[model samples]
Target: MIQLVIVTVLLLVLFFGIGFILNMLMKTTWFPIYGYFAVVIVFVVYWGNAGSLTDNLTEYSYADYIPAIGGLIGAILSGSAIKALRTRGFKMF
Candidate 1:
């Protein structure tokens, strides 16, 4: 659907921004990738368990994590590419 596509594009842009910030602060190519994965795993786990102490709500299905994973991958790739380009004397505007 169009809504899904729009949401996905927004997520990619947001994640890429996060990745870019992380790269700028960390100054390491691999850190953003690892950091993104770690954050996603923690987020999914926490979200899945959010209702554990409540009225016995069910956890999210695996499919629910797909978008987050996709976003993380997009972020990692874009961030690393940006870092590489900047290091190679390319100006990002």
Candidate 2:
């Protein structure tokens, strides 16, 4: 359990670190884009390691894709909502 927690934290740090790099490369200050990139990176990492990580559980499963789909939906919704609010001249408070 402790190992799982440590690995999880390390993965999160990696995701955010990559996100920060992407933000710098794109020259965008918005954090939502970075958040989305973090999710993408996590998903990619999971997919890449699925065979080894989930070998004992199963070879293939739809559950593995849930995180990727959820991340994509969340990013899209957040981006659209922010765009809509900005266009309406409303500040998020």
Q: Which candidate is the best by TM-score?
A: 1
Candidate 2 is scored at a TM of 0.42
Clashes by residue pair, model 1? none
lDDT of each: 0.66, 0.52
Per-residue CA lDDT of model 1 for 2-92, tens digit only, reads 6666666777777777777676666655676777778766665555546552322245544455566668767877677877878899764
In TM-score terms, candidate 1 sits at: 0.64
In order of appearance, the predictions have TM-scores of 0.64, 0.42
Residue 23 miss distance in model 2 (angstroms): 14
